[model samples]
Target: MLIKECKGFELEKEKSNTSEDFFNRSEVTFIENGEEKTLHVLYVRYFDEILQEFTPYSQDPILADQGLDVTFKDIVALVCLLKNPGLRGRKRLYINSKHDFAAYFQDIDFSKLPEVFQSLKQKNSYELRSPLEFILQPK
Candidate 1:
């Protein structure tokens, strides 16, 4: 499926130049179950102490054969934010089925990302109220 629109946000106001940890906050809209649904996605790159390298991560589970064809084990990381009626002015952010607010590294094909994401390095945050095409599947 193709993401019809994508908008990004930066969680942190102050960035540390020395720190290698960074993450992308984006809202992706796609057609699901014959209706349009928007998913909040977070693609993170963090410094791994044990590996001594920057690792990619997401705080949510990538369900296989559901939204995308990829399996959970095939990913580097994922996070999904959903609305919770009980929480006031707060959304539930899931790091996967097992953990909440926890993060782990996952591998994602950088080539498949949209140009908006590719240009993220130049600007830390951006909000574009326009239509954009982002393909998750490899062409």
Candidate 2:
């Protein structure tokens, strides 16, 4: 059962050693129950592969201070919640009105974020991952 398909995405590579420049441009394909879709996502180094990406902005100090670890998966979850307001159920994850979606990260806990971004080197890899990618990816 496929959930989503990322047909295309853009990447902006950097010239520094920072992981921020790793994923310059990339695309993904999502398929679900015979249905297919395309979404734009930023790719970056993950585990042992360089084809993993996620979204929802990790550089935001709010996420860092909240101890919420940001990752590709988390970004997907956020996008899911955004697309489907019903999923919120009783959770206070979404804001009623806000143009800057990243602002929500301020309430999250960076320390509580996924373990995938615990290391410094991996942090660089995190940079490659784009927040917009998660928005397009299915939950």
Candidate 3:
């Protein structure tokens, strides 16, 4: 379904805040089947310890200098892979599920994703946003 068509959703307060008060917000909407669902699309703050557990090999200067942090978008992509066991890769970012993608990012327009990003089939082993298409849909 097109994101523009999905409307009239509200954010649930209890699940809105994360560890760092980053406000992990999402829109709760009722699907055509009358099933209520949530579309969490926000950034999650990560500390050094959490980064160490996920990406011990991260040599990014920003991560080392800032004590390592990741956005909620990063976590969502990771969860997508974890939720789907049949997907194969060396732990990288890529689009695997249309349903999850739509549910998580209702504001993005996937049709305009760049060819390069959309073609990215490999997933990153670390916790990070997938290709541009997976995060921002070229607005």
Candidate 4:
């Protein structure tokens, strides 16, 4: 059976590489089927001169599936979680062709992700660490 959704997500911001222009890099841990699986996430931010605020240019998920247990539904859930719907115009979420979803995203069923996200969000124990705490904590 496919792993349709995770129990929850943990976003721990990773240290930025000075050579890269990324806004935030995170180690996103997905609590799925009583196991903690992780994926690397990178976000590119562009300063909007008119809005006077930083906005996401793109978001990417790096899944090293060598020994990792993940599914296409997890990819859908990840996309639904990371893709900022609040953005007005262009699509900023990017997933490379290596992952399973990259090849069959259009064909895959994504109906269950929304409900999973709602359930995950409503849980009181879920917490995302601040940047400061991320820096202080050992990897």
Candidate maximizing TM-score = 1
TM-score of each: 0.32, 0.24, 0.23, 0.30
Clashes of each: 11, 29, 8, 0
Q: Scored by CA lDDT, what does every candidate get?
A: 0.32, 0.32, 0.30, 0.32
Per-residue C-alpha lDDT of model 3 across residues 52-118, encoded as one tens digit per residue: 3333234322122222333323334323332332222233333334444434344333333322122
List the RMSD of every prediction in angstroms: 12.5, 13.9, 14.4, 16.7
Q: List residue ranges in candidate 1 displaced over 4 A.
A: 11-24, 41-105, 114-139
lDDT of 1 at 69: 32
lDDT (tens digit, per residue) of candidate 1 on 1-139: 2234445443464656632235435554544345655555454433112222222323222222223333222222211221221221232232322222232222223333333333332343223222222113355
In terms of lDDT, which candidate is stronger, 2 or 3?
2
lDDT over C-alpha atoms for residue 73 of model 2 = 30
Better of 3 and 4 by TM-score: 4
Which candidate would rank higher by TM-score, 1 or 3?
Answer: 1
lDDT value, candidate 1, whole model: 0.32
lDDT at position 10, candidate 3: 22
Model 2: residues with Cα > 4 Å off, grouped in runs: 4-10, 13-28, 41-82, 85-139
Tens-place lDDT per residue, model 4, 82-124, is 3422221222333333342233233223343334344444552
